[model samples]
Target: MLNEMRALTVSELTHQIKQQLEGTFFHCVVEGEISNIAFPASGHVYFSLKDSGASLRVVAWRTQAGKFRELLRQGEKVEIRGSITLYAPRGEYQLVANQVSPQGVGALYAAFEKLKNQLRLEGLFEPFHKKTIPAHPRKIGIITSQSAAALQDVLKTLRLHRPDIETVLYPSLVQGADAPASIVNALNIANTRAEVDVILLVRGGGSIEDLWAFNDEAVARAIFASTIPIISGIGHETDTTIADYVADLRAETPTMAAKLSAVSQDELRQALDLFEMRMTGVVREKVTKYRRYLHRLSLRLQAQQPAHFLKESRQTLGYLSEKLEHLMLKRLSCYQQQLTNYEARLNPRHLVGQQAMLLQQLSGLESRMADAVKRKQTQEEQRFEALVGRLNNLNPLAVLSRGYSAVKSGDQLISSVALVNQGDELTIVLSDGEVIARAETIIPHENSPHNKGI
Candidate 1:
């Protein structure tokens, strides 16, 4: 006996088959090298996963693609977690992948480590080779994609910390095969200008392949060769590259880099206020001491009046004259007695001996007195020369001869930006000449591009 046959449309058959495959293979894993990768405007990623034995069509829709787009590339081995499904229109079977990750020993990753070790042996990663990031900088340079999220992060941070800090952007391709060359060129441009105090090399977080440009040998060597200091903020906190090792400083993210490069103006203003207070206190103390000294000097001068000193001197001279007249009369009587005794016993030999002895004593005393006076004069001369030498050392003009200049506003020295304004006249005193100029700008050290944003 024969049964009645029921014919079905292609649409109906395809739909039924799709349901069966989806139901039976609810979940599966595919490990293979990726090929024929295509990312259309729709945001869905289509690629072929191939092995030595066979190939399978795979699709990662927009949602899953977005999660790991930076991790995908052609020829890389990857493990796809997905469910098998049938495409009714094409009459083909494909895998709809929900997750993707690099398979064992990702080729790009192996190369990265190999190169890293090679460079390490060559001492490229040594700490001594790294330059010091300036504590204060006049300008900042940035190297990144103009439209990259990393650039925006850094700029936003800079605005928050120090808007006055000047920044120069060197745009470049931060991903793809040609990204290495673009980054190298940007580095070169920054070095040529040499205007910025430090350069920030930054990019958003990505997989090994996306961030490979920073791992290039050329880029690493260029960073090493740069005379200006460089800060690397290439990826997420967990992500590190060769550039990070070569840079003067490493920041976990672009925003962190900007914060590291500038200081808060409010904090600096507070510090300046404290310094002014201290200086005022010191000056007041000095003024008080000087006033006291002048008061004491005035009292001393009043007590030493010339008229009082003259009257005292005249009275003392009259008394001394009267006493001298009495002493001279007494001495004359004693001398007459001594002379009569000497004449009774006197001889020529004895008189000659006494005269010679007195002359010898006088000569010795004179020589000793002359020697003491000569020594005192030499000591005073030596002390005067030493004082003159010290005075010269403290002279501002002497300092100018050693390549230092002093800026003065009127007669006052200009030590800080707070003391001057735009268009103010200034005198710059150098060793050999003076320059009359106008203050065109006032740049505070704390507001410089390379200060800690305290």
Candidate 2:
């Protein structure tokens, strides 16, 4: 029976150990530095609790995770109240933490707070010192690890929001002892390049110790001194660093930083659509108004037509002709009356000489009267012809027929180049048709002759 000591499957053995450990350490306490913390979407928390000597795996269920997340940070000393248990799948023992309390702030966090306070006193974080982020950045400079998941997140978000936006990446270390220097060097390079509209200093979420480089004094100073607006996104939403405080804007995550840096293409496209609609409405309104005005003008022109004036002139001429005829008839009647009186007074001997002289004088008077009437009629006809010539010369249509054109901006005549600008739309009225044209260039005359006379 001793030699046949039973062989157990690995899974069975693991299960037994798990049961034994759970029974023995039904409750226990763990103190160590938290590291490699992860909070999954399921709301459970998984992390490593490490000391100088060794490390232990820890897991907190969703119920415990929610209560301790705010208090637990990477590299932070914490006391965990939980039970020891073996995980059969991994064949490892882990602490199932049900309660967690901070032992103290980590050294890196202490330094971060100290520098933040010092910078606050120095006014580095003052609103007045911060640069405003452009609403529509042309280019964004991202400073982070080339292979960082944070960079990928930022890139994906930016592409979704604004596919046309250009992004330039400055790769740098985001963790470890040399990370601070690398970040500072990257900042310097971005400043020297000076090509981006804004800078995004971002990194994936990590424990306090892993994100310590962002809390470095030199990196903070570099951010504070940057001319370009900086948006800092380091670690989780609950995590804060010195760089976050000094940056012009703070984003809880790299994805948020990408959004804050640029306006979405859809938003811009919608704005343009609205503007186009408004402009079209304005142009239509103007066209309607001008059409009404033109109609009124046509009516006025018809009312003052030369054909109507000519008709009135013809009526006046007819009235003058009647008056002339009446005057001539009256003169002839008077002559006849005088002739009759002379006949009544005639003697046989005196009548012969008197009749001959009177006949000659009568003929002369008649001839002079006819000549005066003919001259007056000729003068009237000549004056009418002159008036018709002047009217024809003043006709707008006549001018257009001479290869001259009239240009109008809206309904107003464009009399001078000063009234128009490059790219202005104009309606050119020609002899037979109209042409719509856009001004391509405007050349202002220097010491213009028109200005000189004025």
RMSD of each: 38.7, 33.8
lDDT of each: 0.88, 0.89
lDDT of 1: 0.88
The lowest-lDDT stretch of 10 consecutive residues in candidate 2 is 445-454
lDDT, candidate 2, residue 435?
100
Q: What TM-score does candidate 2 get on C-alpha atoms?
A: 0.53
User: What TM-score number comes out for model 1?
Assistant: 0.49
Q: In candidate 1, which residue pairs get closer than 3 Å at backbone N, Cα or C atoms, i.e. clash?
A: 262-453, 263-453
Candidate 2 segments exceeding 4 Å error:
1-105, 315-454
Report the Cα lDDT for candidate 2.
0.89
lDDT of 1 by residue, 247-334 (tens): 8899998888887776666666777899999999999999999999999999888878898788889999999999999999999999
